[model samples]
Target: MSTITLSSAARARATGRHFVPRLSWLWSGLFGCLVILNIAPLIWGILTSFKGQADLFRFPPAFVSFTPTLENYERVFLSGFGGNLGISLVNALAAVVLALVLGLPAAYAFDRFNFPLRRLLFLAVVASIPLSIGAAALLIPNYVYFASLGLTNTPIVLPMLYAAHQLPMAIWVIKGTIEGIPRELDEAATADGCTTFQILRYVILPLVRPALGAAAILVFVGSWNEFVASSVMVDSPSLRTVQPAIYSFIGFFGREWGPLTASATLAILPILIIFALFGRLMVSGLTKGSVKG
Candidate 1:
């Protein structure tokens, strides 16, 4: 029996040692495939941006053999894409600020307080997340309502709409983070004669910095990439955001692939820079927020 038990344990250990390397290889391969899928288009877009109009339609799609040009970038800038970029930056920043300002307090209220229909309200907020994915469906109604109120084509509308669209998700993210924190901290602050606002400002805010960073990234990205609402809500070129501005490269006749790709390449820079700088904070916040205390 002892000999049999020893042999069985050895076999199990050997099996595990073999299995672990295979499992690791499987996961590594899966991750590599995902990276390719996500990054190939971006690489193609950047390469296309630098290609001349003639090089764009080359046989077999020139990955490296084509002569690159700066004309597309020049055209993009000369066409006032710079202004559109600025407008998008402003709108995205405004939306992030507005969403955070409103979301943080609302999240705290939902997590820390009990009121009439509180559960219902929280459910509604969660439901709204799915509904927001169908923003195209709401375009006509939003346009008509805004047009009636003389808010259409205004500078402020996109920021406000972006904020409203992202607010619920922001609240959800922040609330999840808040839930991970212990109530003992709030109680301790209260015992020290801290008011609700003071407690939140000094204690809760410091701890939930990661979550806030994550929420801001989400809101900023959403607002920056928004196209349908930006297109319908604002008519003036001066009020146009980046996505719609890029869409203008498609005309009734044909598409200008060079400038289109160039604009797209330029448009992604801010987001890339942001992610490069604060990605760690965002990841930390998201991971920490995902669990409850």
Candidate 2:
């Protein structure tokens, strides 16, 4: 009886080990499929960008073995997509820099100082979430106001609006990061005869650098992808940003699918590159700031 029981236990243990490997493989394959599904559209767009106009409307869509051409890419350059991209870059960069400069000091002040209406002020700052405004809602007001200012078709308007929109979120993230710093460090710096500016420049800034990078990345991306504000506020060919420039491919006659896709591919490249470079810092900063010690 004892020998029979021992044999049964050994069989059960062996079965469990085999089952675990099977389950893991099953789950891994399912997740892989999900990732592929999510990425398929992007892959299709990229492939379509390389196809000639004739290939684009082919009866049976071919994922491969299509004749590739540079006609779309050439048209993109010839249409002055380069100038539109430069306007977008300038607007996004300027907005990010201005938001950071304005938000950082305000965040430090909120964390370190006690002042009148502090809670109310903090709440006000918290209310400014990025991307909160709907395009339809903003379109009329922005058009009317900027048109009145004689700035409707200028490059300056979008950057200014982008900075205003980003400021609240920037303040919120930076303030949270500043709060994570030890009060003892600020005291230590003071004891060492560090002035307020000096302490902030040397101590606080370095410690919160990751959060700054993370916040800046968020702001920059938001500003870059801004469409409604840029689209409705400015109609000048040279001053248009990437989104409008991409839309130009679609007209009354027909959609220029090849150049449309090609321009889109070019537009999103900057965002992907920025994330690849700063993704680790963004993740680290967000994680560290979420937990208060």
Candidate 3:
């Protein structure tokens, strides 16, 4: 094609882009549907908190409240649900920390070394992805084993479970992040008489801090929301986490909506806030991992 014709075609495409009504409508329609789907449940949950359980069960179901009250929120928050949420938070935090401690070094090794069985082991780890090994199936063995180990029905079990469950993906994430760093950097550091640990501390870790932060959040959030393992492993009252509390709420005598709603709201707020703050870094880490080998 001639340069003039190519330029004219480009200009015409640009002009056409300015008035692409069908494209605009398509995007708007899709966006609207997605927004509604995402927001509706959240809005419904919030609205449900304001209404009494009886109000929620009304024949037609009240979409709009004539007499919204704080009862459900009160029940959720003021009750022991707050304590349960606190337990979940602590469990998540402990799990993420444990994962980082184990995963970072493992990731570094996998990224930097030429050890035997590395690829095989990594593939084995990846293979666990599709396998459903939830606590229900493992319950009998877990009880017997943890009973012998004496870690059963304790808060200590939470971190261990969280880390164990998240260890594979966490290691994968950090290892992938580490692999992106130039190998030349390690050699450069070694030439300067730096030890492997020092190189990791000063070089690799600093460069991959964003990925680490994102991993920490992701690991913690997953653990915090983990219901099955916690429910099966910890039957002690104080050890119970938030999701179990929600389950307990359903069985409680008399309808208490206020505190229940408040607890749910509280449970949601921290994660939402953390994501809102670190969303950019998380996106960047994921993109960086995805685009790399």
Candidate 4:
């Protein structure tokens, strides 16, 4: 009986070890499939950007045999896409700076102070996140308001709107990060004769750097990618942003796929470079801010 029991136990252990490896393989295969699904389109777009116009319509699509040309990129730049790219960069950077400037102080206040209606105000901020960013219903009203104020068609309009759109979320992110910090630090700073602003600058800012970085990246991306509002807000060709400029490739007759893809490839470079450099910091900040300490 003892010998039989020992053999059964050994068989169970063997089965468990085999099952674990099979499960790991299954998960890894699924993960690989997801990665391919997300990355394949981006890879294809880059390849298409390099292909000649003739290769674009070729049967079976030339994955590797096509002779690459810079003509498409040249056309894109000569068509004022370069100017649009510059406009987008400036607007996005401006939005990032504005959102961070306004959001950090509000977030700090929300986390540290207990003013009247503070909870209600924070709740409104949270509610505004989805309403302002996700909903298109506000577009017409915002355009009308801007038009009334003569803010439309100005270079600063889009950046201001983008900053406003991102501010609520930025405040939320920074507030979460601040909550994770201990009040003891603020008290210690106060003991060291730090004023409210000084404590926020010297203590909170350093600790919440990750959250700030995340907020900046978010605001930049949002402003950079914004199209509908930008298209409606500005009328001048010189003031047009990257997305609306990309949309110009869709003419009344047909699409300019080559230049479109080329411009798109160029448009994504800044974002990719940002991610490559600060991707870890953004991810760490998000993770830290999400879970309170």
> Which one is best on TM-score?
4
Clashing pairs in model 2? Answer: none
- Answer with 3 or 4, whichever has the higher TM-score: 4
lDDT of 2 by residue, 1-293 (tens): 99999999999999999999999999999999999998898889889999997899998998897998989999999999999999999999999999989988899999999999988998887865734333456668767887889987877888888888888878888888888888999999999999999988999899888888888998888888888888788888988999999989999999989999999999999999999999998887776677776
- Report the Cα lDDT for candidate 3: 0.78
The true-structure Cα RMSD of candidate 3 reads: 3.9
lDDT winner:
1
Best first by TM-score, ranked? 4, 1, 2, 3
Q: How well is each residue in 1-293 modelled by candidate 1, as lDDT tens digits? A: 99999999999999999999999999999999999999999999999999997899989899999998999999999999999999999999999999999999999999999999999999999988753344788889888988999999898899989998999988998999999999999999999999999999999999888899999998898899898899889989889899999999999999999999999999999999989999998898788867777
Better of 1 and 3 by TM-score: 1
Candidate 2's displacement at residue 149, Å, is 3.4
Writing each residue's lDDT as its tens digit, candidate 4 over 1-293 gives: 99999999999999999999999999999999999999999999999999898999999989989999998999999999989999999999999999999999999999899999999999999988863454467889999899999999999899899999889989988888999999999999899999999999999999999999988998888788888798899979989999999889989989988998999999999999999999998888788867676
Residue 223's lDDT in candidate 3: 82
The residue ranges of model 4 lying beyond 4 angstroms of the native Cα positions read 131-133, 290-293
Better of 1 and 2 by TM-score: 1
Better by lDDT, candidate 3 or 2? 2
Global lDDT of each candidate: 0.92, 0.87, 0.78, 0.91
Using lDDT, rank the candidates from best to worst.
1, 4, 2, 3
Candidate 3: Cα lDDT at 195: 98
Q: Could you estimate the TM-score for every candidate? A: 0.94, 0.87, 0.85, 0.95
RMSD to the true structure for each prediction, in A, is: 1.8, 3.0, 3.9, 1.6
Query: Model 3 compared with the native: what TM-score?
Result: 0.85
